[model samples]
Target: MSSKSINISEEAYERLNSWKKSNDESFTDVIIRVLPQKRNLSEILECLEPIDEETAEEMKKAIDDEDSA
Candidate 1:
């Protein structure tokens, strides 16, 4: 595999370094572990906080209006 050089802020480097599991762990490994994983619609919805009835109705209305366009 080939490696490329990139510059990051000192703060960013420090943040990534802090996530390293061990001295053997690479920056790439830390990044992959920290990044968000893809989820299905149901899985995504399950993660959301419950909204009030008014907010739910507003969201439904907005979605309906967009669909009708």
Candidate 2:
């Protein structure tokens, strides 16, 4: 496999190293596995936390309705 080099801050490198499973694994593999999944825009709007209590309740209801439909 072809490979390319990239640079990151020491702190960032430390974070990835912390998550790495083994010495046999490359940082590239670690990053791909550790990266956050993309959120659907509507799901983000519905599920963001620190939302007001009433807004949270509304979002819960919307999710329930979606499941029942």
Candidate 3:
């Protein structure tokens, strides 16, 4: 396959490296696996699993704590 080179910060490189599943996995594979696919918001929302009331409350509580801090 044809390839192109791009420059990224050391921090970005480290983050991408950490996402590698194994030494055999390439950075391209890691990026494809971790990055969201191009899709409309409605399509994305439709795939989301509904959370239970307890889980929702806990998420809200965490957000509230973050806001207060």
Candidate 4:
């Protein structure tokens, strides 16, 4: 496969290097492993489990208390 060279700041290089599992891992591999996956709101919402009425009430109460404070 063909490759390209790009420049990064020293800080960026250090930060990326810190994520390497071992000297065997490449910068490209670290980036692909660490980057966040794109997900729509609906996709994210689908993963959430439903809360019980009691837990929901407690959360609402906590929010109300914080608002009052």
Query: lDDT of candidate 2?
Result: 0.87
In the predicted model 4, the residue pairs found to clash are none
Worst 10 residues of 1 by lDDT: 29-38
Q: Which stretches of candidate 1 lie above 4 Å from their native place?
A: 37-69
* Higher-lDDT candidate of 1 and 3: 3
Backbone Cα, N, C clashes tallied per candidate = 0, 0, 0, 0
63: Cα error in model 4, Å? 8.7
lDDT of 1: 0.94
- Cα displacement (Å) at residue 10, model 2: 1.0
**Candidates arranged by lDDT, highest first:** 3, 4, 1, 2
Better of 2 and 3 by TM-score: 3
Give, for candidate 4, the lowest lDDT window spanning 10 residues.
Answer: 28-37
The positional error of residue 17 in candidate 4, measured at the CA in angstroms, is 0.1
Pairs with backbone N, CA or C atoms under 3 Å apart (clashes), candidate 2: none
lDDT of 3: 0.96
TM, every model: 0.50, 0.48, 0.62, 0.62
